[model samples]
Target: MSKSTSLLAAVALVVTGGVALADDTKVGILMDITGPIASFIPPLQNAANLAVNQANEQGGLLDGKAIAVFGDTTGSAQGAVDAAGKLVNIENVPIIMGSLMSGTTIAAAEAVAIPAGVVQISPTATSPAITDIEDNDLMYRIVPSDNYQGEVLAKMVLEAGNKEVAVTYVNNDYGVGIGQTFIEAYKAAGGKITSAVKHEEKKDSYRSELATLSQAGGSALVVIAYAGDSGGKIVKQSIEGGLFTNFIGTDGLRDEALINDIGAEALATSFFSSPTSPADNPNQGTLHELYNAAYGEGADKAFVDQTYDATFLTLLAIQKAGSTDRAAMAAALRSVASAPGEKVGPGEWAKARKLLMDGKDIDYDGAGGSYDFDKNGDVSGYIGKFVVDGNSYKQTEVMQ
Candidate 1:
C-alpha cells in the first residue's frame, strides 16, 4: 500500500472511532445528590453507574455505548424542575432514572419529562400518589408504593405490642403518603394514633412538634421523614429533649446520615422499614456480590437494588426499540419487562445483551426481585426492618 493510502486508512479509522464515541447514548440520572436526601445518593449513584458500565462492556444498546448524565435535585421541587429541564432539553436523554424522592420525581415528571416526551424510572419514590398520577405512563418506579410499606410497618408495630403511638411526618408527598397509609392501616389493624403532625423541612428545630407529638406519651414516635434533612433533626431533637425514647421510622429515615446525627448507640432501641431483596431471590445475592466487590457493603444499601433495576430496564428498552425515539422506547418498556422470555438474572447485562442480539425474548428478574410493572408503572416488592446493633445497622426482618 502507498504511504498516502495507509495514512488515509488510519485517518478513516480515527474518524469512525470518534463517531462511535459521539454516538454514545446518555441516560439522565436525576437524583437528590445535593438536596435533602444527599446522603443516600452516593451508593444509589454507584449502583446506576455500575449498570451503565455493564451495558458499555456488553457493547451497549445497539452498538452504541451508554453514559450517565447526572443532575442534582437539590431536594426541592424547583430544583427537580431545573435539573430535569437540563436533562431533557440540553442533554437530550431519551430516558431518566431517578429523583429518588417522591415529590421531586412527580415535579420533574409532570413539569418536565412527561410533556417533553421522556420516560422516567424512579428507584425509590414510593409514594402512593405516584400510582394515581396522570403521567402519560411515563413515570415508573422500582420500589413498591408506601401503601405496602406503611401497612407492614403498622403490623410490625402491633406485633411488638404497641397499641397507640404518636406520629410526625415531613410536609411532603413521601412523608404524607406513607403517613396517611400508616394511619389507615394502623387504625384498621386496631392500633390508634394519639397525634399526627406535619412539619416542613430545612427547619433548624423540631422541638415544638416533638413536644406536641410526645404529649400523648406512647411507646414509640413514628418519624416519616428523610434522614439527611428534617428526619435527622427530628430524631436528634426528640432524643435531646428526652421525649420519646423508642422510635419507628420509614424508609426515609433509614440511612447512615441519620446514624451520623444520632449515633449508633442512640438508634439501638429503634427500628425502621425500607425496601429489600427477598432471601429466596438468588439473583439478589449474585448482584450484591458484584456490587459489594467494587463498592464495599452495597448489599443492604437503600435503593441500590432498585436503582440498578431501573437503569438496567431503561437500557434494555432502548436496545429493544433500536432507536432513541420516545414513543418506541415507552412501547418497548413493559413488553421487555414482563412475560414469557428467557430468564436474565441481576448483574447479567452481558447475558441479556446476547439474548436480545439473537432475537430471543428475555425476562429480567433483578436484585429487587421479578418485575411486573403494573399499568401505573409500579411494582410489588418486599420491605425490611432495619435495626441498629452496636455500631452498625442490620436488617432483622423481611416483611412480605
Candidate 2:
C-alpha cells in the first residue's frame, strides 16, 4: 500500500468508535487508493470504516465483529489483481466492497473475484461495460452506469448552450465508456464536436494535446478524466494556453481537488455531471446527520453516502445469509436490498439485524438511492448537475 493510503487506513481504524474482537469477520475493501484517485479515498475510507464501526456497535456481523481489510489497487490493472488476490487468498474475506474506478473494478472482478467465487459490490464503478459482465450475479454496483450518465450529460451540455465543443478523455475504461457514449449522444442530438482526443494519464503536461485540440475552435472543452490525474492537468493547461474558457466534466473530473488546484474563480463558468442521490429521499438527511456527527465534516464528499451504503449492505447480506457461504450471498443480498420487506435506512444495523433474526425481509433504501437492482445488478439512479461552490462543488439540479 502507498504511504497516503496506509495513513488513511490507520486514521480510520484509530478513530473508529468501537473495539474490534479477535473473532471478527473480515471483509475486503478494494480501492484505487494510490495513483489517480488518491485525493478521493480518505473520506470514502472513513465512510467504509463508519459502516463497519456502526455494525460492531449494533451487535456485529454473523457471529462476531466486522473488520475491514483493505486492498489498495494502486490504480492499475495488475495492481488490482494482486490486491484482490491477497484479499481472497490470504485474508479469506467472503465478500468485497469497493474498487471505485471502473478499470480497477472490472479488472479485479474478471481476474480475481469471479474466479474465487467471491461477491464484490462497488459504490462508484460506473462503466457501461460492467453491465455485461458474465459474473453469474456476483458483481454489483450502487451507482448508475456511465451509459445513463453519458446520455444525461449530453442533454445537459446541449441545454446549457454548448452547441460546439472539443472533447478529451483519458485512455481507460472509465473515460472511454462515458466519453464515447457522450460523443455519440451529443452528435445525435445535433451537437457538434470540433475535435476529440484520447489522452493517457499521469503525464506531466497536456500542452501538446491542448495545442492539437485548440487548432479547431469550439465553445467549451468536455473533459472525461480524473481530476487528480489527466483532467486537472488538461483544464489547467487549457486555461494557461488560452485554448478554452468554458469546461464540462463528468464524475471523475468532479473532485474537490479540481476546485482546489484550479481556483474556484477560474472554474466558476464550469459545470460537472455526477451520480447523485434522489433529492426526495429522507434517508439522505439521516445519513448526513449521522455522518457529520461522526466525522464532523465531509458528509457531502463524492461517493461518501454510496460507499457507506455499500459497506453496510454488504454486512447486512452477511447477516441475512446467516453464514459466510459464498454461493448464498447473491440471493441474500437481493432479499435484503430489494422490495417486499420492511424498509431499512442508513445507520439502522441493529433494526435490520433484528428484522432478519425474526424471519422478516428488508428493503435497503440507502442514502444514495433505493437499490432495487435490475437483471444486471444495476439500479436506476439520479444524476446531478453541479457548479463550483467556493472550495467545493454544489448540485444545482437533479437530472433523472
Candidate 3:
C-alpha cells in the first residue's frame, strides 16, 4: 500500500472511534409503567420525558451530547435490577433515574447500581432504608423518607383525638417501614396501637384480616399499602364489614384511582398523608399547565414533579462533572443540591443553562421543595394531611 493511502485509512478509523466515544454520554430512565402502581406511574414518566425534552431543546446536557435511552421497572425488584443492567450494559448509560417503589429502588441500588458505579436517583422511593443501607453512595432519593411521613401521620391521628389506633401494612419495604415508624412514634406520643397486621400483596380476600383488625379494639385504622386495585378492594371490604369507623394512610394511599375504584362514600371519614402538595408547589405551575395541555387532565398527586426534578438533577450533575463518568457525577450531585448557592426550580431551566455556560455553580430547589441532599441522599419536606371531600382529597393541614 502507498504511504499516503495508509495515512488516510488511519485518520478515517480515528474519526469513527471519536464518533462512537461522543455517543457514550447517554442517560437512562427506569420507571414503573405497568403494574399495581400504573395509575401513578404515567404522570411521573411524562414528567421525566418533559425534563429530558426541555434539556435537549436547550442545547442538551454536556454541550449537546443528549440523553439516549429510557426503560421501565414494572414496579418490581427483579424488574428494576434487569432495567438497570440494560441501561448500563446495553444502552451504555452512566446515569439512571427511576424505580418509584422503595423496595424496587433498594433492590436496584444493591444489585445493579452500587456494584456497577451508576448513579440511581429515585423520585418517589421514601423508605429510609434506601439511604441507611451501608455504602449506598450512588443511591439518591428526591422525596423525603417515610421516617418523616410516618411521624406526621401518627401526629395527625393523635391530634384527631384517636387514642386507640390499629395498623395494617402491606408486606414490603415501604409498608413495613412506614407502619413500624408510625407505631413507634404513636406509642411514644402517648397513644396506643391496639393491633398491627401485615398483609401480603395480590391476595384475593382480606375479609378475615379485616375481622382480626376490627377486634383489635381500635377506633381508627391506618393502612400502609400501595394505592390501586388491591388497596381499593381492602378499603371496600373494610367499610362493608363495618370494621372501622375511621381510616388513615401513608403516601402510598394518595392515588386518585383509589377513590374512583371504591367511591367517595367508602373513603368518607378517612385521612391520608402526602409528602407535598401538588396544587401548591410554586415551582410547578408551568409543568402542571404543560402536563394538562398534553394529557388533557391535571397531573396526578403522586411524585411526578419530583420525578422530573430528579432526572433534571442527574443531568445537572453530569453537566457539572463535564463527563458521563458515574463516580464523578455522583460526587457532583451532593454539591449541586445543597445550600451556599442560588436555588433553581422547575421553570428555571433556561437560567440553569445560562449559569452553566457562564461557569457558575447551581443549587437546585426542586418542585418538591428544597433539594438539600444530606450525606445519605435524603432531604426534608413537609407532610400534607388530606381528608376525603367527595371524590377528591382536601388538604387540611401541613405537618412539618
Candidate 4:
C-alpha cells in the first residue's frame, strides 16, 4: 500500500481508540431501589444523582465528563452481586457506589469488585465485618461501622437507667453485627441481657418474637433491624402486647417508614440512634432544602445525606487522582477522607472543587459528621439520639 493509504488507516485507529478512552470515565451507582430497603433507597439514590448533577454543573471531573451509569441492587445479596457484575462487565464502570446493606455490600465486594478491580464505596453499610474481611482494600464506607454504633447504643441504654435489656435483631449482617457488639458492650458495662432473639426478614408477624422479649422482663428492648414494614409490625405488636418498656434502636431503625407503618401513637415512646443529627444539622438542612426542591417533601431519610457525601467524596477523589483508574481512585479516597487538612461541607463543594483544581488536598466533613475515614474506610462520628413524636423524629441528645 502507498503512504497515503497507510496514513488513513492510522487515523482511523486513533479515532477508534479515542472513543474507547472517552468511555472509560463513566461512574456507576449501585443502589437498593426496591425490596425491604426501598423506603431509604430512593432518597439515597436521589442524593447520588444530586451529587453527580452538582459536580457536572461545576465543570465535572476529568474535563466535563461526569458520572453516567446507575443500577439497582434490589436490597439482596444476590441482587447486589448481579448489579455489580453488570456495572463492571457490561457498563464498564470502574468506580461504583452502593449496596447499602452490609451483607449485600460484602457480597458485591467479594463476588464482583475485588475480582474486577472495581472500587466500591458504600455510603451506609455499617457492619464492622465489611472492613475486617480479608483482602477487601477495594471496599469503603462513609458511615461509621456498627461496632461504634453498637457501643453507642449500649451506652445510651445504660444511661437511660436500663439495667436489664432484651435484644431483638434481624438475622442479617447489619443486624447481627450490631446486636452482637451491643451485647458485649452492655454485658461488659455491668448490664444484664435477659434474652436475645434473632428474627428472619419478611415475616408476616413478630408477635411470638415480641412475646419472648416481653416475657424476658427486661427494662428496655433494643431492636437491631431495618425499619421496614416488618419492623414496624414488630414494634407495634410489641407495644400492643403491653411491653411498655423503653425501646432503643440502632441506625437501621432510623427511618420514617417505621412511624408510617406502625402509626405515630405506637412509636411515640420510642428512642433511636442515627449516624447524624438531622434536627440541628446544618448539612441536613441544606440537603433537605435541595431534596425538597428537587423531589418534593419527605425525601430525606437516615442514610441519604451520607450517601450524598460519599458520592461527592468519591468524585473529589477521582479529580484528585486525575484519572478514573480504580486503584488510584481508591488510594485517593483514603487520602481525601483521612484527616489532617481543610474541611469541606455539603454546600461548600464549589470551594472544595476549586481547592482540588488548585492542587490542594482536602478533608471532607460530611453531613454524617466528622468523616475521618480510617485505613479500613470506616468513619468515626457521634451518634445522635432521637425520639419519635407523631410522624417525625426529634433530636434529644448527641451520644459520645
Give TM-scores for every candidate, taking all chains together and pairing residue i with residue i. Answer: 0.93, 0.96, 0.89, 0.87
- Tens digit of lDDT per residue, candidate 2, span 281-333? 89999988998898899899999989999999899999999988889888998
Candidate 4: deviation at residue 118, Å? 1.5
Model 1, residue pairs in steric clash: 30-99, 35-74
Model 2: residues >4 Å from true position, as ranges?
Answer: 1-22
Give the lDDT ranking, best first: 2, 1, 3, 4
User: On lDDT, who's better, 2 or 4?
Assistant: 2
Candidate 2, 230: how far from true, in Å?
A: 0.7
lDDT, candidates in the order shown:
0.83, 0.90, 0.76, 0.75
Q: TM-score winner between 2 and 4, please give it.
A: 2
Q: Give the TM-score of candidate 2.
A: 0.96
Residue 26 CA displacement from its true place in model 1, Å: 1.1
Please provide, for model 3 over 211-257, each residue's C-alpha lDDT reduced to its tens digit, 9 standing for 90 to 100. 88888779888989987745666787887887776788877888887
Per-residue C-alpha lDDT of model 4 across residues 122-185, encoded as one tens digit per residue: 8888888987876457888877788898888888888888899899988988888998999999
Local error of candidate 4 at residue 140 (angstroms): 1.2
Off by over 4 Å in 4: 1-24, 243-246, 277-289, 292-300, 339-342
State, as a TM-score between 0 and 1, how close model 1 is to the true structure.
0.93
Q: After superposition, how far is residue 219 of candidate 1 from its true place, in Å?
A: 0.8
Q: What residue pairs clash in candidate 3, if any at all?
A: none
lDDT of 2 at 325: 86
Clashes of each: 2, 0, 0, 0
What TM-score does structure 4 among the candidates reach?
0.87
